[model samples]
Target: MSKRLYVGNLNFSTTHETLQTVFGEFGTVITCTMPTDRETGLPRGFAFVDYATSKEAEAAICSLDGKIIDGRPLRVIEHQERAGRDHFGPGGGGGGGRGGRDRF
Candidate 1:
């Protein structure tokens, strides 16, 4: 089956095409995407890669996890579903303890 990989610690200047090119050596890149900030439209310092197969994904991770790209160390791993759920009842998703008084 195809695998999705998470790449972190990316340089803000890196683009989806750059990532696709880098990972393309390992295997066919189905798609590569870099998350961006909504307002500033800047790289969020991470991205996701979808490879044609799980073996390809593993190979990509092994070859690139600690490799430097654009002067930053890349963190490549199998992407897992993020653990963020709606934990708050009202104003949701802020930093820090969930039960803390709103001081910000």
Candidate 2:
């Protein structure tokens, strides 16, 4: 079965292709998604990588976790579905100001 992994602590300059190239060393990367900021349209410093197989995902976690790239250590782990209410609230959007109220 395919496995999904959460890749954290990514550098801002890291790109989707770069992630594919790096993770591709272990096995086929099914999909790589890097979320971007809604306002700035910039990388959110993390990505989700889906591998073709569990073995490949394990290999990537073992070999790439804690590996330094662009002066930042990579945090690789199995993706887990969030439970309960999202900490970001209803729309999963940012909570600004006090008590989840918008300051603007």
TM agreement with the true structure for every prediction? 0.81, 0.80
**Superposed Cα deviation of residue 32, candidate 1 (Å):** 0.5
What tens digits encode model 2's per-residue C-alpha lDDT throughout 1-104? 99999999999998898899999999999999999999999999999999999999999999999999888999999999887786766776765657554745
Per-residue CA lDDT of candidate 1, range 9-93, in tens?
9989887778989999999999898888999988899999999999999999999999999999999999999666766655676
What is the Cα-based TM-score of model 1? Answer: 0.81
Deviation from native of the Cα of residue 78 in model 1, angstroms: 0.5
Model 1 weakest lDDT span, ten residues long: 89-98
Q: Candidate 1's C-alpha lDDT?
A: 0.91
**Segments of candidate 2 deviating more than 4 angstroms:** 84-104
Displacement of the residue 101 alpha carbon in candidate 1, Å:
15
Candidate 1, position 68, lDDT:
96
